[model samples]
Target chain A: MSLKVENLSFSYGPRKALDDLSFALAPGSFTALLGPNGAGKSTLFSLLTRLFTAPKGQITIAGHDLGQAPLKALAALGVVFQQPTLDLDLTTRRNLLYYAALHGLRGPAARGLADEALATLSLTDRADTPARNLSGGQRRRVELARALIHRPAVLLLDEPSVGLDAASRRAITDHAHRLADRGTTVLWATHLTDEVGPTDRCLILHRGRLLADAPAGQIAEGTTLTDRFLALTAETA
Target chain B: MTPDPLHLSPNIPQGGPGGGARPPGPAAGRYLTALGAILHRELARFLGQKSRLVAALVRPLVWLLVFAAGFRAALGLSITPPYQTYITYETYILPGLLGMICLFNGMQSSLSLVYDREMGSMRLLLTAPLPRGWLLFAKLLAGTLISLLQCLVFLGIGYAWGIRPPLAGLLAVIPALLLTGLMLGALGLLLSSLIRQLENFAGVMNFVIFPMFFLSSALYPLWKMAEASPALARACALNPFTQAVELIRFSLYLTPNWPALGWTCLATAIFAAAALYGYDPARGFTRAKG
Candidate 1:
């Protein structure tokens, strides 16, 4: 398993966020976590990335228990948060190098990985440009490039394309799918149905609960994913 | 398209990363790299914001030129342990101003922490494989470095303005300045953990910086405060910042105040521990609602 979350629970004061959420993903699979606004998607991502500790459960990344050994567990993971995390004043290459260093990749080796990630995103020419100079789509691509610089076994992105145009959104989604194809377990969280593919596994989270876990085609029954999602969420409501 | 067939682990030599495909516990090398990266980014950010440098220098410069000059006739100085003769008011307040610079710069760093949290960059940092305490230390060190550079420049300008410390005292003051800066910076770090929003910082400044600066011997001597009020003077003597200022004042005169050093060191330790604890996810605040 690339990722395992067991009985993860979190609370923001009296309000419960994630309640006993448990799921596991195999290596080299693309999984979409579908949820509406305030469905605890961001909360789940935060726990996986270790931003907030889950008070009641265990998380293991590629055989490393997060609670027991955070460094090794975190070393095996990469994350792109729902918000833009780029330092706009720094060049794309500089940003990548900084992230690579944070993940323990540095010097010529860090440079090589950053270069390779840039090239993968067709951002080689844009590498020297400051992040502020890049378009929204290109900036998001740079974030993806930064996340992959460490070559993490599992990658988690929470709403990776929130403010991009249609084309940029498609490109970001395609790149995420490509990362999965290269054997990196990917957990993508978003509310949009168009982003989900028929063959990809789907985990439906609603109001801090995991309502369904199956492939996209199976979640929809005979209806479309959009309708099925609405029906299931409304029923729970 | 890719050089290494293994997607998770890129090829690294023995001394480098152990095995890319499930690299072992982040070794010493990785920890150093993480520290270096955070420092480099902080320095870059500091240099990029020209306005910040100006603001840092200007605040203390105003005190040295305006406030100190205005208070010169009103404040009298006697022969003190740190002073060989009666000194000018600007000279009297110079060390205090240095303390002010570090205090403000420390708070400035805390402000940046809040900004980073808002911008989501802090989240990215929290996710790094290294320990959170190390990351916070790197940040504090970076802020301390910036404050030291500004303090040096301010001291040079003070020398030009006819207020000078002994040439040998310059070298002696470095360790003092560094310790004071770390204590104040760590205090700021601790404050940042409690402040959840950016808008609330102005209140913190009014509630924290003003009181710390005013209650300490930054502008007036503890003896003077005692003359004004014994209770107020006792509070001033007890304040950690007063100890920091006294430490810097004596260091600038080539004197070592062991009690002041002890107090500042203890405060630094306590503030650093509190800041690290605040950033802890399990026990401290860092959790966000979905």
Candidate 2:
């Protein structure tokens, strides 16, 4: 498994945030972590990224234990947090370069990688523009570009397209698919069912519990994925 | 129509000069890289906002040039050890003004944390592959650098007004400013981790900042406080800001107060440790709601 999470559990005092959550993603596979607001998706993302460690769980990213070898595990993963992390005052290229340096890429090599990442996101033209000057979609793309600059084996994205328009959202989702096609294991957390296609694997989480984990096509069957998702979550609600 | 071959090279080494894949060994280089990124980003934020810099400097300048002048005669000059001869109240309060800059900058850094959390940039920083402690340290260092710059600017103005310390004193003052900045910046980090909302931060300033400043030996010497109220004097002596101010005050005269150094170092360690704990992944202070 490129990414494996076993018995992942976390809580905020008495309130449970993730309850025995477990899953695995093969390399080059696209997985969607689908859940509604307050459904523990973000909490799970936090744990997976080791933003905070889960008390009872084992998370292995690219064969490295997350707890014992956090830096190594994290180095193999690229993350696009739900919040935009770019420095608004700095140009897009500068923002990417900053992230590049964080992953230990420096000098001309860092610059070249930053350029390639920007080009991958089709953001080369806007490289010199300050983040504040970019549109919401453009800024989101810049964020994606920054995450990919390090080229980790596993990519974790939390709500990468929360507030974008339909066109932008499709563009981002397509980009994620392309990344998987390029052999990166992707775990994309989001609420929108349409974002997950028939072939994609789906993990439905509700109230801090894994409700279902199966192929998207099988879960949808004859009906649409959105209707099935609402039915599954609403039943628990 | 063509498809690129799937590349699965586990043999890829880690820490190459530049590559998409993670290198083989421990990612020691990430520490410097994360530090560099956070520092660069924070410096941009600190300098890009010209208005904030102007306001930060102007606030202390007004306190030193105007408020100190108005209250100059009321406060008699004392020939303290740091003061070779009779010194005006304005000159006496200059160090305190520098302390004020660090205090306000520290709180301002917390404000940025709250803003970043709300805006989601903080999540980005926290999720990076580097250790969270180093990331916070980098942020503290950046804040210190900015505070030092502001202090230097304020000192430049003081020199123009003929309130000059020995030229050598300025060099000694750098380490003093750094210590003060780190201590206060750590306190700001602790506050930022604890407080969830920007509105709640107002209470921090009122409850924490004002009391720490007023009760400390910033404006008045501990000896004066001893005369006025012995209990208050003890409190002032123990207050961390008192040590910071005393450190800056003595350093400006090329004097080293070991007690002040000890207290400042202890305070810095405690504050930084608490900040690290507060932001720790397992027991950090972030609310479940976010």
Candidate 3:
């Protein structure tokens, strides 16, 4: 499994944020984590990234246990948080290089990979542009490029399309799909059912519980994903 | 199960920051690289904010020029350990004002950390492959360097203002400044971990900065405070900021203050320990909604 979670439960004081969540992603597969607002999607991402740890679960990334070996586990994971993480004062290239160095990729090698990542995103011309100067779409693209700089085996993007224009959203979604096709395990979290492909694996989480787990087409049955999602969530809400 | 299947590219390694051509684990070289990168980022951010630079310099300048001129007659200094002769009030308060630079810069860095958490960059930093303690240390180290830079500029202005320490004394004070900066910076880090919101930080600043500055020898000698109130003098003597100022004062005259040095180190260690614990993933970061 590229990514795996078992019996993951978390709470904030008296409030339960996630409950007994379990899932595993195979290599080279794209999975859409479908959820409504406040469905514990961010909470789960926090656990997976080791930003938050639960007392009642296990998480493994690329065969390394996050709890026992966080460095190794995190080394194989790439994440674009729900909120933007770029330093607005820093140039796109500088931002990428800084991230690269964080991952222990430095010197000429880090610069080379940063340049390649930017070029891949068609952002070479804007390499020197501070992140504040870029459009929202371009900044997202730059973040995506930075996420891939270390050639992570698993990528987790939490609502990456949020606050983006329709075209930018589609472009980012497409870019994630392409990454998965090239053998990177992807877990793209979003509420927009339209972003889920018919054949893609889908997980529906509601109020901290996994409600459905199957192929998108299989789960939706005769109805569209939007209708199925609404019915399922409304049934449990 | 196959050992690995995500072999999309032959040229690029599948491992991230901790993998591939990089060292096996958090090796010395990797730690140094991360440290260098972190410092570089802090420098870039510091340099980008021209207003920050101006404010850092201006605050101390205002105290030295305006405040000192007004109080030069009111405050008189007898020959102290660090003072070779009866010095002007401006000369006596110079070390205190220098300590002021580090104290404010330290608090400013903490404010930025709170802001970084709100903006989500702190998450990116915490999730790095390096150990959390090392990352925090690197941040503290970077903030100290910036504080030292501001101190240097302030000292240069002091030179023009006719408050000149010996050349050897100036060289000797660098280490003192570094230690004091780290001690104060660690205290700021401890505060940042406790105070979650940027708005709450302002209240803390008023509470902390005022007490720390006023209750210490930053503006007045402890003996002077003792004359007013022995209780307040005791509080000033116990304040780490007081020790820091004493350390700086002694170092500026090539004299070593062992008691002040020991107290500053102890405070640095305590504040740093609390900060590291507060930021532990299992504890502080998890409790706070980042």
On DockQ, the leading prediction is: 2
- lDDT by residue (B1-290, candidate 1, tens digit) is 32321122222212211126333453887778788888888888888889988888999999999999999999988888889999999998999999999999899899999888888998888888889888888889989988898899899999999998998888788888999999999999999999988999998889999999999999999888999999999988989999999999999999889999999999999999999989987765567423
| DockQ for every prediction shown | 0.41, 0.42, 0.35
- Screening candidate 3 with a backbone cut-off below 3 angstroms (N, C-alpha, C), the clashing residue pairs are A103-B17
| Tens-digit lDDT track of model 2 for B1-290 | 12212111222222221124443344566677668777877787778889988999998888888888888878776798778899888878888889989999998999898888888778777766778898899999999999999999989999998889999998899999999999999999999989988889889979989999999978887888899899999999889999999899999989889899899999999999999999988777554534
Per-residue accuracy of model 3 over A1-237 as CA lDDT, tens digit each: 889999999989888889999999998789999999989999999888888688999999989999999988888888998889998888999999999989888878889888888877878889999999998778888888888888788999999888887666766777777778778899999999988988989999999999999999999999999999999999998
Ranking by lDDT: 3, 1, 2
Q: What is the lDDT of residue A101 in candidate 1?
A: 82
**Which of candidates 1 and 2 is the stronger one according to DockQ?**
2
Could you give the CAPRI-style class of model 3?
acceptable
Report the error of model 1 at residue B221, Å: 0.6
Per-model TM-score versus the true fold: 0.95, 0.94, 0.95
Backbone clash tally for model 3?
1
- Per-residue accuracy of model 1 over A1-237 as CA lDDT, tens digit each: 889999988888888888999999998789999999999898788778888787798999988999899988888888888889999999999999988888888778778888888877778889999999988778888898788777788888899889876666766777677777767889999999989988889999998999999999999898899999999999999
Q: What ranking of all candidate models by DockQ puts the best one first?
A: 2, 1, 3
Which pairs of residues clash in candidate 1, taking residues 3 or more apart in a chain or in different chains? B9-B20
